[model samples]
Target: MGLFTAIRDVLSGFKSLLIGMRITGREAAKPILTVQYPRETLKMPARFRGHIQLILDPETGKPRCTACTLCEKACPSECIDLDGLRREGDKKKSVSKYMLDFTKCSLCGSCVEVCPSDAIEFSKQYNVVSLGREQFAQMDLYAKVEAEAQAWAAAHPTPPAPPTPATPQPAVTPAASIAPKAS
Candidate 1:
């Protein structure tokens, strides 16, 4: 009975080894899914959310944020801090400084949804890395976007200036009429 039991234990161990080898073989035969990062980057899916960035208005070349504070209120993590100033001639307050503390962000999309002007959107930047936490603690979204806009403006040629219309001169009255009428 001891001999038979020992043989059975050996058979069980062999079976387990075979199963492991089979799985390994199958996996080894499959295509390599490893992306050689730095040399090759994987395209992020459309819905991939990395961080919040202010959207620039194409027409104005400025952030669409009106400094309404709706996004700040909607953020559950309370990572957003911003200020706005209404210029003397401006109708709405323009965002003066927009800061994002990414350390506490939950990526809940609450801020993006609550924004009435669609001023904010999730950034596609997925490779964010840093040596210290402080680098990401206070990201100035307003200044970053502003710098990008300036760089783009420098790269692209400005549109041609609209032609100024010629001013019309008043017609001269007849000399006879200009003189006092004989009475």
Candidate 2:
């Protein structure tokens, strides 16, 4: 009786293995779930977070970013960095250095969600192949900003000189205050 039971258990295990193999074989023949590179790429949604891309103000052509640094705070990876340009008054600061180390990015999209000025976003560009470490930390994001700063300065002329203030006038005492009231 024990020998017969052992034989039956072996047969049942083989049967179960065959069933699993059949399902795997069927799945392999079905349509693939991955996108083809350099060919049939899937269209990404408006907010499909991928590579980190700068958020630009369409009107200013510049960063449109007010250097609020909200995106930096939200970044989990801390790959994004921004330098606030120095300004005297109303003029905006030029970006001294705007960098995003792509290697460290986690593709979490936390930075994009917190951007108040819509100055941080993700791009559809997936091919970021790099050989060296420096290449991985590409500084591609700053090029557009540099050109915009130049163009903004050229198009928007400087304001005219601030008008001088007039000379001070003596304070005149009214007659009612100087003369005593009559009985």
Candidate 3:
């Protein structure tokens, strides 16, 4: 009876192994989902949040950030450092420096949501890497935004205002055309 039980246990283990092998073979027949890393890259979805970037105003050709520091306040990781300089007699402040620490950032979109001016949004730059720890540790997004704004301005110059048409005058003045009534 003991020998028979041992033989049965060995047969059960073999059956389980065969079942696993069959499943694996079936799955192996399907096309591979993996793509070549560098030579062939996969496109990210539209909503993929790679990082934060600033929007620049076309009219002023500058960053749209009011530097309210709302984004900084909203960031959970405290990765955002936004600073602005107030002019002597100005009510609004212009962004002086803007930095982001991507290592700590969770890309939760909290900062983007809290921004009142719609100044910042998630960037499409998904391929971010650093050669060393110091490199790309703290990125100044404001400078990149300014440079892009300038480039856009140069590329898309506002067309010159249409030349004003000369105002038309009556071919003949009423008094001049109307002969003095013969008295």
Top candidate by lDDT:
1
**Model 2 Cα displacement at 180 (Å)?**
70
> Residue 115 of model 3: what lDDT?
90
> Could you say which candidate leads in TM-score?
1
Error of 2 at 181 (Å): 72
- lDDT score, residue 120, model 1? 94
lDDT of 3 by residue, 1-183 (tens): 999999999999999999999999999999999999889988888998988999988666778898999999999999999899886775789798999988789999999999998999898887887787664668889889878987988988888999998999768667756877667
Any runs in candidate 2 off by more than 4 Å, and if so which?
1-36, 87-90, 138-140, 147-183
User: How should the candidates be ordered by TM-score, best one leading?
Assistant: 1, 3, 2
lDDT of each: 0.92, 0.75, 0.88
Candidates 1 and 2, the one with greater TM-score: 1
The TM-score of candidate 2 is: 0.55
Alpha carbon RMSD to native, model 3: 5.5
Evaluate residue 175 in candidate 2 and report its C-alpha lDDT on the 0 to 100 scale.
88
TM-scores for all predictions: 0.80, 0.55, 0.70
lDDT of 3: 0.88
| Tens-digit lDDT string for candidate 2 (110-180) | 88788766776777765556678896575567675667667876888778999998998999999899999
